[model samples]
Target: MCSPEMSRSSDVDVRRTETRHEATHVKARRPGKGGACGHMALCHWALVAAMLCGPARTQRPPGIPGRTAENDVPLQTAAWLAEGRITAIHLPKERPRRLYFTLPKKTSAFSVTVVPCDVPVEWSLMVRTAEDEPPKQQRTYKKSMPEVWWGNSRKNIKVYSNVGNAVDTYRGPAYAPASIYVVKLQSREHSTKVSVYLQEGAGLPKVFPELPPDPQVRVVGVGMSSVTLRWPSSPSVPKVHQSNTSLQYCVLVNLKHNYRGLCAALEALRRDKKIEEVKRQGATLWPTPKAWKQQLGPHRKDVVFPAPVPDGPPELPCVCQGVENTCTVSELQPDTLYYLDVFLLDSSSGSSAAYTGTSARTHQEARPTGTALRDSKPRWVALAPHGGRLLSFRPRGWPPRALLTMQVCSPHQVRVTASGQTQVLAAEIVAEEPVQIWLQGSPSYLIYLENESPATVAEEAIVKIQASSAYHRQAPVLPPLRTVKSYSKLKTCNSVTVGWHGTEERNLYCVYHQQLDSQGGPTGLEQCLGPESRSDTERAVCKYFQDLNPQEAVSTATIGGLEPGTAYLFDVYMVRRFGIAIKYHSKIVRTKKDC
Candidate 1:
């Protein structure tokens, strides 16, 4: 008997041959006639032929159902076939069967698998572009193989060979919607049953709902250093989940003085190029001024005034819940234009959309311009004897030679005293119904209102003071020359050391500073002195003078809590014993960028 031998032929026909019967069949002993066993051989050959050529049936593999035809279709026609469906194909002994399929819109990737049932037949697969006519051969594979193809267009595709119970996946290039694809299967054997699965990209959204539009915003009020914003509630769109319940809003206030120029430059760039292209350039798009030394070289000798510092954390947006729909943003610069952007936030998705709001400018505070004497309330003091009260008047922002007209109305007798340069000018009591006095060169004066009348008389009195120029309409005296000799600044990352020299002996020296913009103009006043009192400006000046020695000449004050990489203008003034500013000096310095 002959033994079965393995065949290495690539053709599928090699596995099915009549030589196996000749090798495994046993010979029967004939009767004594010794005739040839050709008849028995003929019977056995007929049975083997019947078993191989009879009606062929194949069972479906596990996890896959349905049957697919073995017919060839036009490549363009198959491009529209539904995806994710298993199609069965019968391998023929002749030409390959071409199955055309189409990828859905926005299909990023695709996969194809071929599972062979019954016999493992040698098959070839080729992926081709969809065409009106028959597609030309691009890639070919032999034997049972699974493969996936990827391309931007349906022009040329990938191919695989010898696929069995294996899946091939490919991530196609980004293609337009509804591109065509085709798969060709060919084998050297007939009646080979194979299942093919085509799955498009996953994670594609089946249904999408519309989102609500942005809410309309309005500016309710704008104060000197704060702004109040209000917005209407947003309604959810149809077919979308209601987001109003979980919605939140935030107010983004931009210091317009600092960003307006940059925003204008960006707008010009947008006019020249696309906004996306301009954004790609990043920070380069914003116009940055020259270095501080270069920009302020010409104006270095000019005097700079002390500016007000910002109060709280800068750049912190004001946030409010959706239900309130209103928010107040504070700690803003006065007399400054500010741009406001309101955004609606979705808590569930963590998404935000901007609202339309108009820009606003804060009102400037009431301040003295130049050489103007403004009237202010008197400082009340409790004096000894009969619980009497004294009214203290400090002629702030008044010229040294300008006289002040003082009027006092008290039920009891009133005594007025004026002093200057460590000497009393006058001290006298008036018995008239209203007392009046004219005084000059007195930094400050005190009025002693004594309750010397009957006990029924009240202890309170009324005092009114006005500048002599206001009543006489005469030109006021020019301010006295400043006592500051020289000034210098030493700046660190977050602190500044200011040292100055005074020429004359005075009451005290006070230092004030404010933040400056790129152009050396004051952005706001920075309070390095201390917390403000009832009379903020007066208290600041008083605290500085009172804290220092009265006769100190060389003074150095360090101001901390300053922002890094910022420029500031420091002013030093020598105040007289009566609160008169005799001399003043200013210097500009920039802090270090890093510690």
Candidate 2:
């Protein structure tokens, strides 16, 4: 039951047919016929014939063509993709279906959403529109669209492609007078069914007509699970567009299509029995990041981004609302492409003015919560009472060497360690003086800044690193990190106050305390909570003072109702939307005993 328009689903795990295996029977198109294969989960394409025997629903096994002029079902009524039959084994396969529909005349914008009923399948969509044949810098809005027949010549043809239904932009009044849209759906083994939605609305809305161009944005840096973005704080509004209402930038993050299939594929690979033994030992799926890289070689440039599953906490998802131009969206899926939209909104009128859209891919591995530097530049880092800063930079050439110049105030010392290196470097600075050091090259260097100033005082230092040749150096903004530092400041016969540093950017945290046994190990479940309130069950237990408590200081909490002269351990954990980081702090302290 294969049709002529199936592309590889990057999971090209070529194998002999197994029991009810999926994607085994996809129909691939002929090599010389269709368009270039996109680097995505492509499993469907349209096999359009130039003739129409009847109305729009009369779709027969038509020959291969791109867009035809007759009998397209006018995209009128709204349809819902719900109530699908579960795919069963031994069922006859369904051919990939292409539903052609023409947008109504005077159409401004619309969006397409295709969701699979069961197992995920990549669907294809194309809209034949017009794009400028001229260079982008010179291209400007003409009074009207060029007078040309659709699909008649190469200059007249510009196909907007939507690889999978993670929602294409609420874009386009369209390039030409009549933009014909077509959606290709695949019926693979598991249900081979997907619900397609065709409606008119803005997803990542195109710029409004006559509105001034939206303010521009720049990418500061991209880490594994976070993205740092900077845009203009006060984007100018035209006199006509400006009103009494204040304008602010609205930033929305949407998931991209590139990493969706790869996220799915790498998850399946993790279930292999061979990797099972190694899984229990650590954070990595394989023995090392290098070994994990080797396993994903079959996927080529894909499969590195492993999106946290069940589901990611929404992308429109996360509304990155800001009055200032800079913000970092954290807790994002690693190795995934994130579509970002920054627009100016008139808060009083509740209407949007100008906007810009862009996309960036996150790093494969989640980096620590610190100012991350990819370029060799100067950075000023503020030390939060024993906090650390990581200086990440590139080298000028092979056989590497890079120069670092650091300035620290009097009574402060800086401890520097190169991440992923054999040798470490450290230096101390005299008050009001600058120090210079040469660092061995690596992707990043971890440097901890410490000051002899009072604990309540925070210090800022100027650091400049020269890796590659550069004309001008820019400063870095270091985000905070959760160190293993903890303190038990106040204690009584029955209570004690404990605290640990929590990440200010990601504030969700949990602190747990349990009484330790004579050997300093966690005692039985019952004795852990209380000597009097013992547990009847034999399992060991750990109790948290605050579980995912957002409002509390989260960094510190007081525990009461404890046994006298008892030894207890306190631990701090940073809670994330998908999962929690490693135990940041675990220390044992003694409760004071009454005379």
Candidate 3:
């Protein structure tokens, strides 16, 4: 990155270097139609004399008193313009023959132009009129087919390079006013070689300034039935001279004080037009005062109020749901007196107004009660195992097994007795929240039912199981298979770890071992191998489980100490806490003898 100081110096150097050179080509003119000036038109003697003289031959140029040849001093190069040197002299079509010139390259960088008549532009400064002018600067860039360079406005101006060879025609004024402007060719590698050209009378005609923008207006707020309007903040401008450069604004408002009155008026207009589209939708919209109030929000003071809620419902239930912004009113007799309030909201004006109207009505029949629970499906009561405590009963009717309605309705310990049988189930009721009671069987079948009424005596509304042994059937369950992995063999002995996984929620594991005869039948399997081989070891058995390698799989037990080349029978069983156990026997594996 270039340092700020270096950058500034480079900028100044490009515009102010004192190298001056003579114009390379002699001046010549090419005339077209009448009053048409060509690229080198100033070179014509007649035009040159016309530019230097006053039309009436009476008024002199602003600075000259006596016409002297000294005023025609040799013109300076664009770079030497800052030392108070004239680059070119411009002539007015109608005259006092005004003259205009600008510092050369300095003018090229901006939208600067020198008009022969010297009145300053409005809303912008006139450089000549200001005494504190800063030193001018220029920046140079390498030329390309489509040359993109920054102008004085800091906006890029595209100059087409392919148009002319060695000679570039500038379609637009290169900023400054002058009959001649000059630029030098710096060598390809920054070598200070120089060249010059006189480019006076080479620009197109100038254009005028554009028109101003439209004003901003808005509807800032809207209520249930009203609206507010506003406009953006604008700066005040004072009337000035004869320049077409000023702006102005205006405001207006319309209001419909009462909502009913507005709605009625709208309805009346709609009827006169016979417009079906003007009819209200299926539901009548009678917005409540509260709804209108809420719609106005904090800006309520600036809006029109809406009509109040109508008085009536099927039964005018103590509690009811109302329309979004509206409130509900109850307890008025048929044909009672009521008033409606409407508001007008003008957010733009920051103002509001309310209007009121009266109305009367008659009542209608009451509505039906809403549904709470459906009755098509059988309600789930409870599911439990046999021999476990029966928690509670529901509906308190005959058969008494269907409905699961009662959740923590009574203590879990509650019991009912009937027909010489005492109900043994109890429930635990938790306070504040819903609780559940699971039922279990006691060796018999039972049916569930409900009754509309219950008997006062224990004999009435009685709940009883139809069968005494309805709860004893064993639930269908599967036994687990025994598994052994990571087997190892040593001299005369084989070892393996045993374990199992089961789906039965009540299953437990038990390991067993035995020897097989030649016929593959167990032989003397019950013989004691000491407590080390004991499966029922709660009484006494091995002290510690065998050590396993890090790479070994995890299992329940490690079995060792087998006869070399002998087949063995190993089995594991799944046992339930209160039921029978099933064994899952494993295939025999012979031991290897190498020791």
Best by lDDT: 1
Return the TM-score for candidate 3, rounded to 2 decimals.
Answer: 0.17
lDDT of 2 by residue, 1-595 (tens): 3222212211121122221233332333334334446312233322322132133322332212212232121223212122111111211245555544455565566655453433445456555554534234322423112112222212323344444423233245544444345555654554333434455544532221123344556779898887877765443444453323244454545442212222222333443445433333212211112322343445423322323211212133223232446767676666777766565544333223334456788877644544555544445555555665555555545445454555443245555544534235545542333344555545445554544455665654323323332223322211133343434447787877766544334434555666778646432221112122333331123333332333442455667777888887765554333211224435677788882
Error of 2 at 329 (Å): 5.9
Q: How large an RMSD does model 3 have?
A: 28.4
Q: Which wins on lDDT, candidate 1 or candidate 3?
A: 1
Question: Compared with the true structure, what per-residue lDDT tens digits does model 1 show for residues 1-595?
Answer: 1111121122122323334444444444333243565656656776786575432211111111112121121122122235555565656665455565655455676665544543343444344443333223423322111111222123554445564322233334433333345465655544544556666765321111112364456788988888788766554322344433444454545443222121222223333434444333221221111221132244322312112112221223343333346777776667777776655544443333445656787776543222233443222233333454444445545553334433333334545555443356667664422233555565555444454455566555443334332233343222233332323336678887766554433345666666778645321111111122123332223223222333454556677777898887666655433322322434677788977
Please, what is the TM-score per model? 0.25, 0.22, 0.17
Candidate 2 vs candidate 3, lDDT winner: 2
Supply candidate 2's per-residue lDDT for 275. Answer: 48
Query: How many angstroms is residue 388 displaced in model 2 relative to the true structure, after the best TM-score fit?
Result: 21
How many clashes would you count in candidate 2?
A: 7
* Model 2, global lDDT: 0.42
Query: What's the lDDT for residue 18 in model 2?
Result: 23
lDDT of 3 at 566: 68
Model 3, span 352-458: residue lDDT tens: 22223222232322322221122212122221211122322222223332222221111122222111112334333222122223334322212222322223213
